[model samples]
Target: MDTADRLIESTRALLWERGYVGTSPKAILERAGAGQGSMYHHFSGKRDLALAAVRRTAQEMRESAEERLSGPGTALERVAAYLLREREVLKGCPVGGLTQDPDLMADPELRAPVDETFAWLRERIAALLSEARQDGALGPVLDPADTAAAVVAVLQGGYVLARAADSAEPFHRAVGGVLDLLGARVTD
Candidate 1:
């Protein structure tokens, strides 16, 4: 890839592997195999490059979710598909992981994409739940908005749990539990 692209990609990986506080411009340059001048020439500085990386990661997360949630199936099936989708369980959610970075969270520009991504995901999942309720695929008792929020929470929490334990089992169990709860609410 080109210099700018390499820089952004390297930053993205660094941000995922190391939080904003841990990811250094020097490390980014080393990872990208680019010179110091290349980073400055392409962007203002580390923050500028980080913002680009964050935006790209957020966009990718949204696209992947949309692909899974929008696919054909019952709403419950789609939701399950999203929850059970392959992921780097130990690495954690790229966008969700950023929320743990104080430096990143303190900067509104850096935090906006992360906030927007979760908001969009909750809304999208809510829409799916709403559709299911309307079509009698899901029970009417479950509130779409609340359940969506819970779904997002569970997924994020699963990542934390898995990371803490240094095993993917916690993540799998959490997902399976959520799926069971959702499945129980599905109408005949």
Candidate 2:
């Protein structure tokens, strides 16, 4: 890839691995195999490059979710598919992990992608739940908005729990519990 693309990709990995504060320009340059001059030539500075990386990550997260959510299935099935999709559990949700980064959240520019990603996810899930409710796929008592937030919370919190326990079981259990709560069946 080109130097700029390399830089952006390297930054994206670093941000996911190290968070915004831990990802340094020197490390990004080293990872990208590009020199300081090449970095500067491609982007203004660290923040600029980080923003690009974050935006790319956010887009990727959304697209991946859309793929699963829009696939052939009932609303609950779509959501279950998303929650059960294979992931690098210990590494955490790329966008959700960023929410814990104080430095990243402090900067409006840096935080925008993270904020937008969660907002989009919540809205998409809410819409799905609404569709399910309308079709009587979901129970009458379930509120789309509240259930959406709970689902996201469980997933995000599951990551934290898994990380804390240093095992994937917690994450799986959390997902299974949420599915149980929703009375969603696991169909092939």
Best by lDDT: 1
The TM-score values for the models, in the order shown, are 0.95, 0.93
Best candidate, TM-score: 1
* Per-model C-alpha RMSD: 1.2, 2.5
50-138 per-residue lDDT for model 1 (tens digits): 99999999999999999999998988889989999999999889889899889999999999999999999999999999998998888
lDDT per residue for candidate 2 within 53-88, as digits (tens), equals: 989989999999999999888988898899999999
CA shift at 128, candidate 2, in angstroms?
Answer: 0.7
Looking at model 1, the pairs that clash are none
